[model samples]
Target: MTERKEINVLNENVARIEQEQPIGISVLGPGAADWEFWLTSAGFKLANQEDADVILWVDPEAKDFPAIAKDPRCIVVGNSKTNALCQQKKITYVKDVNDGEGIQRQLEEFGRKTRETLENPTLAKSRSLTVPPALSPQRPEKKHGIRLQRGLIKRHLPPDAPLEDPKGELREEFREESGPLSRRKDIIAALPSLGEDERRLKQYIQEKSEGEYRVLEVAESYADLIRAAEKGFFEVILVHRELPGLERNLVENLKLLREKAPGTRIILIERQSDDFSAMYKGHLDVIDLEWQVIPELPGHLVSLLKGQYERQPENHVVFKWEDERKPVTSLPSVRTSVLSPALIAYHSAGGGVGKSTGATQMGFVFAEMGYKTLIIELDTEKPSLLRAVGAAEDCPGLAAWNHSDFISERTAIEAIRRTSRQVHGLYVLPVGPISPKKVVLPFHLEGLNGGEEENVDPCQQAAVFYSAALKEFQIVIVDTNNSCVDPPVFMALKMAKRVFYVMEATKVFLDSAEAHIEQAYDLGIQLSNYRIILNKCTANDLLSLRTITQTLEIPVSLQVPLDVEGYRLAAHQGKPYKPKTKKGISPWGEFCQNVLQDLEVPITTSQAKKPSLRNWLLGWKKKS
Candidate 1:
C-alpha cells in the first residue's frame, strides 16, 4: 500500500509540472477527454488543435488531420502500425501509452526536445528579429543585476567627491536652521534598503545643491517612510520603486502618503523601461532613470531643483534612452466647497440605549446655543423622533421628501418642522411612517415599493436628503438605527465627520458594542472617526468603562450619569428635559452641558437661566 501511495504521489508531481508548461498540447481522436485529462493532470496545459504547440493523433485509421498537425511538432501515438505510417510521412511516432509511467516519460522527452529545437540559433534569431529588444530575454535576477550595476557606477565616481556624511548631521542641522516653516526644500529619500543607490542619490543631491537642498530623513522600510511623511518632516519625498513593502502595498502606502503629506511633493524613482501609467494615476511625480546616466544623476537633480524653484507645473520627470523630454499630462485638481457643515451621527449597538434621545437632545442644545441644527431620524424600521418630539406621526418629513417628484434644498427645508419653543434654532426631520414601512425591507432583498413612480434605494435617497440638509443647516445630527448593519445607518456612519457610538453600562450592552465595532471595522469605518459614549452610567460603571477601554482600545469620550427618573418623566410629557434645580442644573442638564463642552460648542452666560419651580416640582412628583 505504501509503495502504491509513493507511485501515486510521483505521478501527481509529474502531472503538475506538465500542466504548467507554456506550450500546451492537444490530443485528437477517440477517448480525447480522458487523454486530455490525464495529460493536464500530469502537468500539461491543454489547447485547441490549431493553437497547440504539439498535436497527438491517437486514432489508428484517422485520415484527416488538423492543419497544425502537418508541422514537425506533431506526433502520432498508437500501436506498431501507427509507428510504421508515421515513418512513411516523416512524422514522429511513439508507442501507445498503456500506463501512466510510460506516458509520463514520453511527454517529458517531447517537452525537452521541443524546448531544445525552439532554442536553436536559427529559430532564436528569427524570434529576436520580430520582438522588440526591450521585451527580449527577460531574466528573473534583473532586479539584482540593476543593483549590481548601481554599485559599479558608485565605484567609478570621481575620487575628488567627498564621502557622504555617515550620520547625515549636516542635513539635520540645515533642516533645524531653516525650520519646517521655511521655504527651503527639505528632501527625504525612502529606499528599499540602505545601499549604493541611496548613497549615490544623496551625494548627487548634496553636491548639486551646494548647501541649498537638505536630505532631512532616509527611510529604509514602509513603516519608517509613512512615519516620516505623517510627521510632515520633509517637503519632498523620493520613493524608490523597488522599496520593500511597495509591490504588495503600493496603493495603500501612496494613498496614506498623499493624505499625510498633501503639500509635500512625491517623486517615484523607477527604471526608464518600466510602465508607470498606474503609478501616474496617483499624486506622485515619476523620475525615470537608466544605468548609463547614474554618473550624470547630479545634472538631473539640479534640473529638478531648478524646476522646483521655478514652480514648474509638471510633476513628472522622464529620462529616455535618447535623452528626449516627454510631455507629462497633469492630474486634475480636486474641488471642495468652502461651506462644509459638521455632520455628526449617533449610533448604538441595540435598541433602548438612548441613541435617538441623545442625538435629539444634542441637536436641541446646539440650536439653543444659536447654531442652526437639524436632527434627522434615519431609523426607517422604527421611526421614533415624531413620537419623541410630540409631532404628528403622519407629518410629511424625510420620507415625503425622498419619495417626492423633485427633491431640492427647498424641499428638504420644508420637510423639517421646528421643535418646541424650548430649543430655538432646532429642527426635526422625522422618519415619517409611510417611508419607514416602504424602506424596512432587508438590504439584500429588493423591490421596495414606496407610494412613488419608481423604486429608489433607501440609502441613496437618504444621501440626497442629507446633502440638501447640509446646505440648509450648520450642524446635522443623524440618529441611526440600533443595528449597524442597516444600509442607511451604515451609509450615515460613513458620511459622518464624527460618530458617537452610544452604549449602556452593562455586560450585554458592552458585548453588543464590541460586536458592532468589529462589524463597523469590517465595513471600513476608521477607529479614529468614532468615540464611545457610555450612557446611563452609575458609580459602579467606572470599572466597566476601564475594562471596555482596555479591551477595545478605544477612548470613552463621555459618560452620562444614570438619570432614569429624569428621562422617564421628560419622555412621559413628550418634551426635552429641563434643569430641575434652582440653579438651572440637574443630572440631565449637566450631561447636556458637558456634551456641549466636549463638542467645543461656545457657551455664553446668557444661555443659562434660572430653573422654573413649577417644572421642577412636576418632574420631582413624576419621579416619586
Candidate 2:
C-alpha cells in the first residue's frame, strides 16, 4: 500500500510538470468555475494561455473562434453549448481533464513519455494514512449534510452568466481580501512561530517609537490590517516573513491594494539577520535586522512609521474638459479677479431653483482653474447642491459634537473629500452624512437641548466652517438652503463677495426670487454682494430674468442655458461634467471666474501661485 501511494503521488506530479507549458489559459463561460476550484484546491499556478501550448475552450455555446488554425493543444471539452466559437479554429477534443480512468488509459495507450522520475526529494516524507473507525453516535442523528449531498452549490450561479464556471468568489476573495480561506490559514499559522521567536524585536520598536509616535498593536488578519489603514484608523503596516503559508495569491492581492490605494506604505517582515537579497523584488520598505546595523526592529519601525502615519491624499480638484486637463483649484485666488477676502454668499426664498447646482458649478470650476475653493453645503432639508455635486452623502452635514461652536476646527476639514473627478483637475467633497435628520437630546442630559434654534445654528456655523477650511484654501463658496427661522443665514448673505440667486424664468420662480431677496435684505445683507443666476433659462425667458434682476438691487450674473445631459451623467456616475471654453461656460464657474478676474486674481501661470505640497507634510524634512 505504501509503495503504491508513493508511485501514485510521483505519477501525479510528473503528469503535471510534464504536461504543463507556459501559457495564459483563460477558461471563460462554464469552465472558469471549475478552473478556479481546481486551481485553488490544487495550489496550481494560473498560467496565462497566451504564452501556453494549449487553449482549453470549456464552454459549448460561445461565439465562433477568431482566425488561427490547426493546433494540437486546442482541446474543447464537455458537452458544451459553446462549440460554435471554435468553428474557425483547429479543434481537438478532450471530454474532460478530470475524467477518471479514461485520462490515464488514453495516456498509457499513447505511450506518452514520463518527463522524469523523482526518486529522491528533500522533504521529510511519510506515507501515513490514519483512518479512524466510525464511532456510533450516542443517538442516531438525521443527516445535516443534505445541502452538500444534493449538489446544491451550482444552483447559486446567475442566469446565463459569462464566466460562470469559475465564478470569481474564491479568486476574488483571494484577490480582494488576500484570497481564499486556505490562504488565511497560511498567514495566521506563519505568525504564531514568529511571535514566539521575536520578543526583543517588539520591545526595541516600542522604545524607538517614543513620544507622539507610538506603536498601535500589530494587525492579525487581512481585514483587521485593512481596517487599520482606512481613514482615521491606525497608521503603519508592518509585515513579517516567518509566515510559512505565504502564497502567490497573497502577493498579488497586496499588489492590487498598492494600485487602488497608493498612499499606503508596506513594511517587509524579516528577521534582523535574514538575507535581504531574496526579498528586495517586492519593492517596499524592508525592515530586516539581518542586513541592517540598526538597533531594535520595533523602535526603528516606530521611527519609520512616525513619518508615514496618517496620510490622506491632499484634496485636489482635476479639470479635464474632454482631453485638456489640469488642477484648477490650486491656482492663486484673485480678489473676485482682485475682490480680496470677499465672502461668497448664496440664498433662496423658496426651495430648489438649482442653488446647490449653481454653487457646485462655481465651486468646482474655481477649484479646478487654480483657486483653493471649498463649497460648503448648509441646507439640511430636501436635496440641494450637495446632491448635485454628490456631496450630500448623509443629510448634507458636518458631524458636530455640538452647534455652540464646532469643537475646535479639525473636525470640519478632516471630513471633506473630493466628490467626483470631472476633468484633469477637479474634485468634490460632499455634504456630511444625514441620518434620522434631527439632532436629538437625551431626556436627562440638560447641557444640550433640542430646539428650533438648531435650524439657524448650522447656518451660523457655516461661516466658521468656511473660514477654517479657507486657511488652507483660496476660495470658499457657501450654499445656504432657504430657511425662514435662521437669522444667521441673513448674516451670511450680507457677508458675501458675490451671491448667486438661481431661479427659473417662470413667474413662480420670479416670485420665489423676490421672497429670497427680501429675506436677505431684511437680514441686512449687502444686496450688492448677491447676483442673480437664471438656471434652466431659455432664450424666451431672458426678458423675465433681466426684469427680475433690475427690479431687485442685485444684477444678473449669468443666464445659463439648461445643460441636463452632462450634469445628469455626472451625478449618475459619481463624476462631474467638465466644461469647455473659459467664457460663458457653467453659470457658477464662469461667474466665479469673472468674480476672480474682476477681483484681479491672476489667471495665467506667469502670475499663478507656485504648487505647494510643502503645506501638506513636513515643514522641514530632508526630502523637502
Candidate 3:
C-alpha cells in the first residue's frame, strides 16, 4: 500500500499569516488614523482594500459602502450613522474608539477574527486561494511534477520485471543532484560566544556538505533562543554548555525549549573529559569534541536527522558515594536542643495498613523519651485516633477548630486532650464529630471566618493546624488518609519534614507502595525525606529486602514483626499496646527503639533500665 499524507490547509494559512508574516489590514475614512497606528504597532500590515484580508469601515456615510459592509470580513468602527447602518444590516460593530483600553480590546478582537478567518475560511468570503497541490509553498513545481511522473511510471511497470529499490535510489539521486544551496538544512546554534570552535564547526559543516547545511548563529541569551524556537524556524538546535544566563538555569531553559520545539533535535556540545557530560548524555545527544572533530560533525547531524542514533536511555540517575575513613578525636561534647520541631507524617498506600497505629506508637515513644509530642488525627475520613487512645469521642478537636473563626494559642492548646496517664507528655487532637462521609466537603461549607480564613486553602487546613500545634510542642505526628491523591494527604506530605510510608510485605501491598512512591515523586517530593516501613514482616521474608529496595529505590528503615494477638488485645482495650519486658527487650519494644534510633533521638536513662527477672518469668509463663 502507498503511504498517505494528511494536510491541514487552514492551520497552514493561519500559521503563515499570523506568525511568519504580518497580517494585512485596510482602514477607510478620516477617523481611522488611530486605528491604523494601533494596527501597525501590533504587527499588522497596512494595505489597500483590494489586497487586504480585513477591511475596517469608520465613515458614517460613504458612497457605495453597503456592498462592502455586507461582506462578513468587514469591521464597522464607531460612528453614529455607521452604527445604525450596521445594526439594521445585522453586521458586527464596535461602539468605542477614543478610549485607549477600548482600542486595545478592538485590536485583540481583530487579531482573533483574523486567525478565525484564516483557520475556517468560507469559500464565498475567502480573500486568499486554497492550499495548492504541494503542501509547502516553497516546494518547486518542477520537482513535484517529476515525482508525480515517477509514481505513474512505477504503477505501469510489469509485476514480473525485476525492480530496484526505487525509494533508496531516488533518495541517493536527490542527494547527488541537489547542491547545498538547493537542500540546505537550517540550524540555530545557541552559544555563549562566537569563538573559533563555533566558527570552525559552522565552516566545517558548510564545506563538507557542499553548502547543504546552513548554521544560523543566535546569541546565547535564553530569551532569544526561546523566541526563535517558538517560531519553529529551525530544524536543529545546537546548545553549548556555557551559554550565557544558562549556567545555573540550564535544565529549566532546555525544558522550555523542548516544549516549544518538540520536533527539533537538540544536541549538547561539551568536552568529552568533562564530568558533567555523563549527566546529560541520555536526555539529548552529547557531541564530544575530543572524539568527534569538526569534520565528522556534519555526517553525525545528518544521521540524527535520519533517526539512526540509539534510543535514549532513562534520563534520571541517582549517584551514591561512601567513605570508609573513621575520625579519632578527644574533646568535650556539647548537646544542643533542636531549634525546630520535627514534623512526621504517617501515610500508607491503602486503608487498614496501620498508618494510625504506627503514628500513635511513635508518638508514645517520643513522649517516653521526654519529647513533648502532639499526635493530630488528620484522617477526617475515619477519625480513629480518639478511639485508639481511649479519649472521649465527642471531644472538640480538628472539626471544632475548623468551624471556629479564630483560635488563640491558649485555645488551640486546650483543644488537644492529654492521652491516658500511662503515656505522659503526649497529646491527642481528635477529628471531632464530622462524619467520614462528609469530610470531603469544601471548607467553605463550615462557614468559619476570621484570622487568615480568607487566604486558607481547604486542602491545606491540615498544614495550617500543624503549624499552630508546632508553637507549643516539640514533635508533631500526623496520621493521614491512605490515598496519595487526597488533598489533605498531599498537604501533609508536602509540609512534613519526614514521612513514614507504611505498608505490608505482601505482593499486593508492595505493588501499591511502588505506585504511591512514584506518585509522590511526580509531585516533587524529595525521595531522601521519605522512609519505607514494612509492617507485619516475618523472619522468613527477609530475603525479599533487596528486591523491595531495588524496586522502590528507597531503603526500608524498619520492619515490625507480625503480632496479631498483641494488636487484637490492644484494640479490644481501646489503647496502644505496651509490651512487658524483663532481661531482654520484647519484639514490639525492639521495633520502637530501632525507629527512635534511626530518627536520631537520644533514649532516656529510664528507658535504658532492664525489667526484673520475676516479671520476665511471669511473662513467659503467661505466653506458655
Question: Which number leads on TM-score?
Answer: 2
| Clashes per model (N, Cα, C within 3 A) | 6, 85, 2
Q: RMSD in angstroms, candidate 1?
A: 31.2
Worst lDDT run of 10 residues, candidate 2, spans 181-190
Question: Model 3's lDDT to the true fold?
Answer: 0.53
Residue lDDT tens for model 2, 12-110:
644544443212334444444544333221212344555433345544343424322343334555443333334434455443343323332333222
- Model 3 segments more than 4 A misplaced: 1-340, 403-424, 433-455, 540-543, 575-584, 587-624
> Cα miss at 210, model 1 (Å)?
66
Stronger candidate by TM-score (2 vs 3): 2
Question: Quick one: RMSD of model 2?
Answer: 19.0
lDDT of each: 0.53, 0.41, 0.53
What is the alpha-carbon lDDT of model 2 when measured against the actual structure?
0.41
Per-model TM-score on C-alpha atoms: 0.39, 0.45, 0.39
Ranking of all predicted structures according to TM-score, beginning with the best and ending with the worst:
2, 3, 1
lDDT winner between candidates 2 and 3:
3
